[model samples]
Target chain A: MSTAVDTSAAVPLPAEGDGTPLKKRLRRAERRRNLLFGALILPLALVVLVAFIWPIGSLLTIGVDNPEIHDNLPRTLAVLEDWNGSAPPDEAAFRALADELAAAKGSPAIAAIAKRLNRENAGYRSLVMKTARKLPLDAAVPAREALVAIDAQWGELATWQAIHRAGGALTPFYLLAAIDRAIDADGDIVAAPEDERIYVDVLLRTFWMSLIVTVCCLALGFPVAYLMASLSTRHSNMLMIFVLLPFWTSVLVRVAAWIVLLQNEGLVNRLLMWLGLTDSPLQLLFNRFGVYVAMVHILLPFMVLPLYSVMKGISPVYMRAALSLGCPPFRSFWKIYFPQTLPGIGAGGLLVFIMCMGYYITPALLGGPKEQMLSYFIAFYTNQTINWGMAAALSAVLLAATLLLYMVYARYLGPTRVKYMKAR
Target chain B: MLQPYASPVERAWYFGMRGLVGLILAFLFLPILVIVPLSFNADSFLMYPMSGFSLRWYEEFATSPAWRQALMNSLIVSPLATLLAMVLGTLASIGLVRADFPGKALLTAVLISPMVVPVVVIGVAMYIFFAPLGLTGSYTGLVLAHAILGVPFVVTTVTATLQGFDFNLVRAASSLGANPVTTFFRVTLPMVAPGIISGGLFAFATSFDEVVVTLFLASPEQATLPRQMFAGIRENISPTIAAVATILIVLSTLMLMTLEWLRRRAERMRGARR
Candidate 1:
């Protein structure tokens, strides 16, 4: 193909009287086409940049954003600027804190500052709130003495250190907290308390659950894909509807179906009782079991579709040839057929795994608190706790994992795998 | 079919494989099918031994203000989002196919990133981004977010259709004294209409069924059907959700059938031209 193109280029076209001018006109026309195409794509490119890329980029930056502390406590931060780590902050720092608290009393910024401080030390929220509430603005005594009287926590070295650490415009607090590590009182990174060490476990659980779901999907999807591929085209087409039907159905409805089926009095439990399998209904819903069931059901088609597409392309001739050479059927199938389907398996497995890692609704509705994945925590922080920084940090982690998997898929299996999935 | 030269053991293996496949298919279909019958049950509880068949849950769904409002919201949002997605996605796809440009691959990746990114991530990011702009809990916000999610589908379907399109037809029309706009309307649009319509259908369905974003961004007034159902399932499992699910399932089945029909027609048209 390259030689043919080269020869054609070398031969050149039959020249007219004004060949150079005509060539220039062709080049201009090519440029015009390029410009038109760029013009057409401009709207979509802008929309994606504004709506998708910009928002995500901003959200990820929240991981290091620490404006609430620095903005609200400028005076306190300034007074503590010269304090060393040898002991508690001086009277001047406490005096600055009391004055800032009095000046900013009843302000929303104070509350925001309190929330930020609370994330660093467990009881600092109440301390800040209490100090700001009872600050003696009209007292004759020093502002430091008034603040210390209001709350002795103001005299603690650790409290001053937390405020000092949060003084920076950009802090690693949220990101560190996301991985279940935090800055200790002496400015060293250490593991969070035993009970607070939940994010790492949740992240691990997210990976483990996604892995299990992917494996389950593969186990259940392989035979079905094989059957679809080996069957007559007419039969395969009929069977394909079953796969496509669920694929087209809303994921929520499918999850709702699982809820109904797996509930204590629902179909699965009732069937178990009817068959004399157990004395009581099992604790199926609101647990890992329920999460696995629903996620596997929802993601099975993602696995099967790719596997079937790849399997469909594999000819039966190779397996037959191996069997005709006196190779046993199972051995021939394993060595000859399975190797040909690896691309499909890789595509499907990666797709399912990535999807399961980020799943929220099914697990949220069906799983217990402990069974929830990292996405659930991200939502929890975003909606319930109203912790945007923590939410963004968690999201950054999820986004990283997803992008890494996508990069691998694009690099190895090629972008066609993604395009093929979309086509289905 | 199994070869005649195969041993009995091989035949048994084939039968076993078929049996396993059949069971797996059953597993896939059973849960979805169960909801259909359970939706009609007179009892409110999702349990066995139906008391009798009635449409009480369906009636409740229709009469309840929340469910009705949610349905209305979904009806309002999906079409608007679908229209926006169709316009943007179709134009982008046409340009992508017609011209070669630097960073085209990167641009395609970015446009399709919404589909690949986790909905939770998108939801949180949009929530934070929209809060200050006052887009959260508004119709415009939901429509825009849903449109972004839907664009990739439209782009994919339209690009596929255009791949088989002959650009010479447009040139032929222009050479024959027709304007470019007229050539597009009279020639190009007719050929790609199926893809556009089906892509629109997908966009509409995606918006209609989306929940996580709605949960984060929608106000009480803008709550969509899936959002309402999610609340229902989370707070309480009732037959009303079943009725809603049943309706949605039937609606999706119809959409799937329409898409399949469109695909077959498109194939036949392409074949005839060949």
Candidate 2:
């Protein structure tokens, strides 16, 4: 290779840094750097494209695509296309509806279609199933009479319209459920049942818990991180073991530990009783209190790491200079030292808050049923009820909230956060 | 210890606050400390009054089929997922930190989004996404889901490590006739090994602990340890759970120790190499 390169050389080399050829080499090096950088980023971009973007796109489509409605009742839908949202249709539409319903009655499509339509109306399954048993003939009977002949419930026209409205590929069922509103029999948005109308509250609670956890972690972490930054690197490294130990521990173990410690006959109660602080054991487990304790413990490191990184970068000279300029020690520390650490505080806060919002396990295990977060319901709809539509909608809301907070952080706090990088 | 920095009035406040925070840190570790001793119980029930220190629970955990299976499942899934996460995440971290590209911030956010998004959401998403692909309840599905969750940790750690990286080293390598691939292997991966390893351990521990997503994505035949523990916890409270937990605590402690040592070694190595 060396011989070939030497033979191919067009001209003799001059001293380094003196030749115009250096510029060409520099350009080639620059191009190589660019290529390497591009090559490195391309794989990651592709991973994100497949992993995050594709799944989210498919998830969002669940809120609209009513495949069950489209697939199971093609003839009925096509015949009723000209029904014009008036009375349920003439005899031809009724006959088509009877035929489709009769065909789907015993098949998997009926159950699946029933499940989809039930999101619109809970009684749709029974109405469709009952109407299927009797296939009314096309005899020009009055609209009300024709429906009555098939099933008395169909005379109301609302159930028929639900099936009719859902005939289109897109449906508003999931989005409506997301807002705690569902389409009424008459096609109006109304509040869901009292028991089921809990998404709004769950969303609110998720926000509130996240906010509280962020505040708690920030309050606790700021001081510790500051101490770490101010101390010798030796001391800081030693202290970091405490932060990293929990990081290495399984979250499940941490929560389980909380369960044991917070129970009625747990260590805390034993200690309290031994100390004569309380005669009785406290009901500390399975509540918001437990949720907070475990969550704060688990998330404490998230808050501390960012703050430590930021604080480590700040020069102590600022505080010393302030003190030399006739400022009080405490005032200098507060005014100069604390202000610079704000970037860390904001970054840590945003990170902690965003993490807390998505908490599921600690809250699920330690929290009461009422204390469950939005993630709980999202899971329930997905696993128990198999309602993918509502799950997608709820997930969308969570995503939106997360994105909004991220936007706020990026727009407002991003620039100040640069101080978090240690100065070389 | 905190009082020297305090004023007359602030002295008492500092004492109380420092005492409280110290107590809180102790409290944070108390559960782990408590369980270690409990694992030596002679009796089957988990109670305060120790019947006598014995290794019976440990023996039971080691002997029970369910417990053994759960442990095996955890052992199998966590390391695999961790390795996958380390590879993808380190690659991603290098890309994210070293490369300047449009939508880099969004890309970073997307990479880390799995960390904050509810595991249940991930579970549900995987369930719906993987069901059609026939991946539900398989080792591959669970590992993929866990790797997705674990990637963010590796990326975060490696990115943090890379922030302190010297680009001049890469330039030096290139000037010495090393190709980009050679430079990355020689100069970059070695530098970030500690962060990568720590991130991998965190990723493994993360998957080991995760239950909700496992419950949704994994089948009964493929139940991971945490999923098994979850079933046991929900169905009945047993000393077996405590034993299982204690074993995990021990394993995690070992991993933590190794991580600490590796990190310290990496720091020293970096200093020496520089």
Candidate 3:
């Protein structure tokens, strides 16, 4: 703001600076205006950069973060740095482990290191805890035999291997495991054991479930959008409330409503029983079928809105001319109308698919545990297990997939249309 | 999409497509409307074949301390978050529209990234990021998180409004010896007020409906209505949640109507000027 800005006289006055030339003052004024606007933008820009983007960038790196072991067990890892993977390190490495565990015995770092090692090999938590609990070994006695005397696991090759594997300042453990792979005791990457090989399947299932929902949305949304676009503005506006109402409604409310409607004794089952479609109330809720129904219902509007806009922009003249030239109706519709709506289909499908890949609440509520998506697992790790690294690893994958799909959608819709107004 | 010609197949197809569209529309409306009656059901179970009509569920929502607290939390958090989002979003959008910069596209993408990023990712990110700062489970954290989520909508809407704005008016006022601040207050704000209000409404609705982040961030003491409803849906499907959903449905309807009215009024104003 300038001192001259307070004036509201009818006639224009000279520029503010007295000595300087008018041209230079005008240039200075332009610079000041630029600075003012930049100042106006700075607060929100700084807030987003610090509070949003930086945090997310740091979080994604947490997938590979290995601070716990690196900070806590620095001596043991340093001793083992020169050792080969096939066999255990010698007495000095054992001495370092003993000293480090003794120092970190009662601190939270021991528990953290123990947790980190336990991921390398099961039962290592209790081994490390027991050794840490009985630490500060006698200097006269050899560290190897003394540790072996404390816990028989210290004599085993696997214990040393687990310690060696977890000693890195930054490890690919969580990120690798997110895709159902892990480093073996011998420091070779291998497929996770059959029982632990769940995340890859989970990732695939997330994609598969998202694909099914996207296809279902297109199938259901196509006719609705077509009709809505084809209708008069008055009728279309009335129909719009149907789409927008559910669109604006909270996902939780819709989930609750779907549960009330699809539960065993609920309306869908009751109607099915009354109509003799089934002999009994079907197992609807907490099943894949219910998840599909609810997800399609919730996501139908996303598909419809974009498709409706695209279809509305398509003139009827093209199809009419094709038909007027003696082309069959179905052929004309397929060759002309369908091709024109391809961009809409791509945009809506990508948008819906991207959304479905990250869906948590609906599937967690309506579907069984087996049917939950990647987001469900991310939440499970964060809330139930408090495994931030694992959660972040899963998040990194989902975030990448989501951003990649968004880029594709943006390519289809262009930059300005990237604004998705779907309520969180 | 029908022709007045000549075959049973075409007629069947015409009726079939229309009927399919009708059923799809009904499908969209059914889940939303079905819960309204259950909110008033006297029975404990959330099922069909209502036993009786009663306002007990609504009464429960009105009286239960948890429900009351959640409603209060929603009412308090959303408006504050909306106000913050509106102010910051209005300022950033004005700056964006008024200035030219080399990194403008990058800045916009960064700003709008919150919308495209999944809520679960944002929720987890907020949890981990806020926990050490003692912001998780606090009102300040929740409000900031929600305000961030709302900024993109405000930017998009305000930017749209500013697109049709006449810059010559500002120049005219300034040349008449009015200061920039006076010109802005006397000319620009009144014109863009509608866009700000609509965007603020969106921000409010978003914060009111948000639950995923709250589940990670909010304590029981800070639970909003959607968080409470999520817990109800997870633990048990009860009539009380139905009542809450009904109220939320009504609220969303009112919001939609307001947005529609705003859209029409903006259109009418522009039409009048034209």
Best by TM-score: 3
Identify the CAPRI category of the predicted complex in candidate 2: acceptable
Q: Score the docking of each candidate (DockQ).
A: 0.48, 0.36, 0.58
Per residue, candidate 1 scores C-alpha lDDT tens digits across A350-389 of: 9988888888998888898888898899999998988888
DockQ of 1: 0.48
Candidate 1: list runs displaced more than 4 Å: A1-24, A75-102, A114-161, A416-424, B3-6
Q: Tell me which of candidates 1 and 2 scores higher on DockQ.
A: 1
lDDT of 2 by residue, A1-424 (tens): 1111111222233356765688776665555544555565566557656765677778878866679979888987887787776675676666666667667877887787777677677777776666555544454655446667666776656766877878788877777778788777776889988887878888899988888888888888877787778778888887776776666666766776777777898888899999999999988988888888888988887788888888999987887789799998778878888888887788888867776777777787788997788888888888788778888998888777876876777676763322121100
Candidate 2 clashing pairs?
A: none
Per-residue lDDT of model 1, residues B1-274, tens digit only? 7889978887998899988888999988888988888888987787767889999999999999999999999999989999999999988887888768888888888988887888899999999999999999899999999999889888888888889888777667766876666777788888888988888887887888889888888999999999999888888889898899999999989998998899889989988998
lDDT of 3 by residue, A248-315 (tens): 88888888888878878888888898899999889998889999999999999989988998999999
TM-score of chain B of 1: 0.95
The 0-to-1 C-alpha lDDT of every candidate, in the order given, reads 0.84, 0.74, 0.85
**When only chain A is evaluated, what TM-score does every model earn?**
0.84, 0.82, 0.87
The weakest ten consecutive residues by lDDT in model 2 chain B span B20-29
Chain B alone, TM-score of each model?
Answer: 0.95, 0.88, 0.92
